[model samples]
Target: MQQPGTVDEVWPSHAPENYQCPFCDMASGEFAFPDNLCEPGDLVYSDELVLAFIASHGFDPEPGHVLVTPREHFELLYELPDDVAARLMIVTRDMAVAIKRAWHPDGVTTRQHNEPAGSQHVWHYHQHVLPRWNNDGLYFTPKRPIVDPAVRARKAAELRAVLEGGPTRH
Candidate 1:
């Protein structure tokens, strides 16, 4: 399917000059950037097309928030090819299930942002899979401090184990 919009006209990139995309780095098995909060052990799932990992920043009382992103760089949702967008959505659904199985949250939510006005700091396209509970106030509360790597790793492991040998899709 054609992209819904004229990407060039509707979605301008926000990346800075000489931008080193952290998600691309993580997908390629590199996480050495000093500014990047993601770590090697934070990855929970991967395939030829996408990667899913525990986010470095999370809401209070819920630290295992997940991000599903395309292996290739796509600055905004309007830029994704149909196949990449399909795979991204599939992985997003799988990550949400994994979160439910691992964390047993009262509920779950997924969100994607496109531009600066939409609060998308990262230029790459990604979907957030967050565990939700009643009265959690996820939208109002600020993200908690950068989570410790060890905790993130553990959370990743939990979801990784749950997803291992779980599904195979192309």
Candidate 2:
């Protein structure tokens, strides 16, 4: 399915000259998330098309946050191919389910940002799947800081086990 706006329309370029895309390097195994926040062991799910893993940062009430991204670098929602978008959505759904099973959160939320105005920090496209609860206070809070690598790895393993049909908390 096509996105809301014209598929061929060009976006006002916001990228700087010689801009180094961090997601590209991460996907390519060139740069690792600082302090091992995201390591290969943190990968919960992946295929030839997409990668799903625990994000470094976690919301206050629920720390079982995840991110699903295209294996190749696509800057924004409008730039992603239809097939890639479909795959990412599927992975995101799977991750959401796994989070629910593993963490037993009251609810789940999926988020995607576009350009800088839309709060897209990293240039590469990604979908955030987070567990949520009523009155969890996430709405008023600032973006959470990156958690310790050990915690991230443990959470990743829990979600991966759930997704893979291995032992899980629930």
Candidate 3:
């Protein structure tokens, strides 16, 4: 059931004091932290409203997972504008197609989290686009370490190449 609600009543931000937002840094082309997981090289796609990049962390046996997020920093889904939300979905779907073209997996999966209880680690709202194979165990697998920059870059390059070929055909 859908519950109509206001942002304040439904979503409370969980960011710590003086938190350095990694997604914002990536969106701004300023991935400037020594320990930040995301890097500029991980970026696969970006428009005025959204950005898609390979996730630094990935599920085992299914590396190079992608994260699609809005350009602005919205700590939780409750804060996203309707237009931003629509753009996120559009980008998410395109990333799925790109992943399919690049990896040829059996299928694709999309996931998003809200608060800590909902498994959201980063304060930014992101939708995950994961390529799925039978028995991949994605739901059961914990995230692996932050992938190496070169590897992430290679994956990003693959997706970017696919996306650059223009919109996918039906």
Candidate 4:
């Protein structure tokens, strides 16, 4: 596993001109985001500005991890508009609370990566809201493979139910 502060060696230093941003396509509903288990309709929460869904990649420590992103594609933190960033943060916080209530994990973590050197595999800006437990070894272990799509869709539905039920308290 790559250290928290170090870049992944294979990550590109610059965005290639031909690089088709998956997030943009996902936002446009061009297709299901490649490798993601949840479809656009499976989003747990969405508004005019943001969307939240269960992540395809599962951290070994937690299976029902969630990702929150702007409806508009922002490739990096620097490129994100202030208003969208603020809205995304709010959604991230709300999703963290909902994840905690729905999954009942010991704790919760929210993470965002900037560029290749920051260990950002995806070019689009997003926040990962993960459930955590003691000694889960998140930074020390490799991320688990994508969970089964049916399972992910079910997880997304569960989270969506929680989110729809009412407001979440920290």
Candidate 5:
């Protein structure tokens, strides 16, 4: 399939940015919400196959990025069963439509699991609905630049709260 608009010039994926696994001295909490793990629940449901979180931390590729993720620890998409796949597809498609209907993005991208070679870090199965816009940004967006050191620390703390499903933040 055609690669959706990439932030290649700006936002590149961290090779081995394995939030799932961390090297020594860094500590496991360091990897907490390492990358784009923030999402607010515009809508959500938990079934046998998957659980989803509406993207909370979003800008440039704007706020509508939806994450459809499996509940069980299925390493890859191939690991998903026919029934799960069917349900995932339904949710994925619905989110795509929802992004279009709600955000009116220039385009919508449904990026699924990628591996070490393809830059997959998290072993569990997941898909991302990144809403795209003209000049929303490629690599690092102007609106969503790399968080400053303090801000990054603060953001991680904020997401720690959200990821842990604790208090809400903005």
Candidate 6:
């Protein structure tokens, strides 16, 4: 079933661009996408081989979350060549550290790989890092707030700092 509208626009259009994937195309700058999506585009960190970005269709299971992705657009973790798989950990680690320091969250949750039975939405391989709160009207699972712009800026700063080299204090 459709997980709502986020993929609606992205999915159908992806096929016509000569079999190109939107995420990969977006990361490659071969197409135009929304700007200032998360302080400065969905992409936060990108190199010749990898790219990290804040999730755009973030009607999230939890708030203050981000997604780190690879440039080549592998469909699943197992699809990645060994070298790419290793780099994914580095990106995940860096994102986790930044999320911890910036959000002052009670903890962070890391998850990857879901299935038809596991509620995985996008087919592309990516990692999710969710910032947690303490007794913040959330329980067994989590909830997303309206995500104010000011908070987004602060978060961008926090992630940027962590990327630069800040302590990942709890």
Scored by lDDT, the top model is 3
Tens-digit lDDT string for candidate 6 (81-145): 55677788888888889888876778777788654455555556778877777655433555777
By lDDT, the better pick of 1 and 4 is 1
Where model 3 places Cα greater than 4 Å from the true spot, the runs are 1-3, 6-10, 140-170
- Lowest summed lDDT over 10 consecutive residues: which window, candidate 1? 1-10
- Compared with the true structure, model 1 gives a TM-score of 0.76
lDDT of 4 by residue, 105-168 (tens): 8888898998877888877788999999888878546789989999999998887776566433
TM-score, candidate number 2: 0.70
Better of 2 and 5 by lDDT: 2
Which portions of model 2 show Cα errors greater than 4 Å?
1-10, 32-37, 140-170
> CA lDDT of each candidate?
0.84, 0.76, 0.85, 0.74, 0.59, 0.64
lDDT of 4: 0.74
lDDT of 2 by residue, 53-163 (tens): 778777675566888999987778877767888899888989998988988888888999998989987777889998888888775467789899999999987876655
Candidate 3 yields a Cα-based lDDT of 0.85
Checking candidate 6 for backbone clashes, the offending pairs are none
RMSD of candidate 4 to true structure, Å: 16.5
Candidate 3 has its poorest 10 consecutive residues by lDDT at 1-10
Off by over 4 Å in 6: 1-20, 32-40, 59-62, 136-170
Deviation from native of the Cα of residue 72 in model 4, angstroms? 1.1
TM-score of 6: 0.60
Name the weakest run of 10 consecutive residues (lDDT summed) in model 5. 21-30
Q: Return the candidate ranking by TM-score, descending.
A: 3, 1, 2, 4, 6, 5
RMSD of each: 15.0, 16.0, 15.4, 16.5, 18.0, 16.7
The order of the candidates by lDDT, greatest first, is 3, 1, 2, 4, 6, 5
